[model samples]
Target: MDHNIILFRLYIIIALCFLIPLSLLVSIQLYSLFKSYALTYFLLNFFLNNNKVNCNNKDYDTLFILLLKQQRFFLCISSVEYLLSLRYSELDPLYMLLAYCYQNHNFCYVAEYYYLKALSCSPNNEIILSKLTQVSSKLSKHPKLYTNDGLIL
Candidate 1:
């Protein structure tokens, strides 16, 4: 009886040693997931509410910075698309923002299109010109002007 009791106690201790760390890891994971979801919810609500009114550059900048910090490029793209649908007069920045999101996703063609739109709106914007150049280079392809014999047309 004494030996059985000791063995039971040892088993209990071993089980607790494993269980405790497992529970702690699970709790930490859950907490982080909850925190991320809560932040995403809050930011989405903030963005939707702000869109109801006429937002200035500062507001969009804040939202853009937050979304970028969170690495929520799709959300940024969608939000910018929604704003673009509203036909805001100062569209250069919106176009630039959309181009940036597309660029991050490696959609160089779409990024180039938006960058061109932005450049058309603000012809003197060096930043837009630079971004357009970068995307253009990425999308560029060498022409096949020479024949199989290396003869020029």
Candidate 2:
């Protein structure tokens, strides 16, 4: 009876040893997760309120090179919203700056893509219409720009 009691007590101690450490590890991981979530929330809010994150000229130049020279599609596409927020009005004769930026970035397909997008907002625009015609003409020849429907020309 005494031996059985001793064995039971040993079993309880061994189970506790494993459980205590495992519980502690789990608690630590949860705490770390909560901290990570909180930090991400704070950073997101900071960037949202700040609009533009201050970067050194060299950093700006590096990003420009990456977007324009390296043809980083994501970077060029992401800037469209910010570019559209500029002072150019829908009635203005100026070229769509976002489209121009895509052009300067050598993202001609995206530039032509945005020309149609801007036209949806300003369909009667002669400048936009002319630019669209020119871009479409260019696209007809650049087989890479054609759709699955087949070549335009």
Q: Number of the top candidate by lDDT?
A: 1
Where model 1 places Cα greater than 4 Å from the true spot, the runs are: 1-40, 141-153
lDDT per residue (tens digit) for residues 72-126 in model 2: 5455444435434543234222236567676765677887877777788778887
Once fitted onto the true fold, the runs of candidate 2 whose alpha carbons sit more than 4 angstroms away are: 55-153
Q: Which candidate is the best by TM-score?
A: 1
TM-score of 1: 0.62
Question: What is the TM-score (0 to 1) of candidate 2?
Answer: 0.36
Model 1 residue 98 distance off true place after TM-score fit, in angstroms: 0.6
Model 1 over residues 105-132: C-alpha lDDT tens digits? 9999899899989999999998997788
Each candidate's lDDT (Cα)?
A: 0.83, 0.60
- Predicted structure 1: clash tally: 0
As a whole number from 0 to 100, the lDDT of residue 99 in candidate 1 is 94
Deviation in Å, model 1, residue 31 alpha carbon: 12
Candidate 2 local distance difference test against the native: 0.60
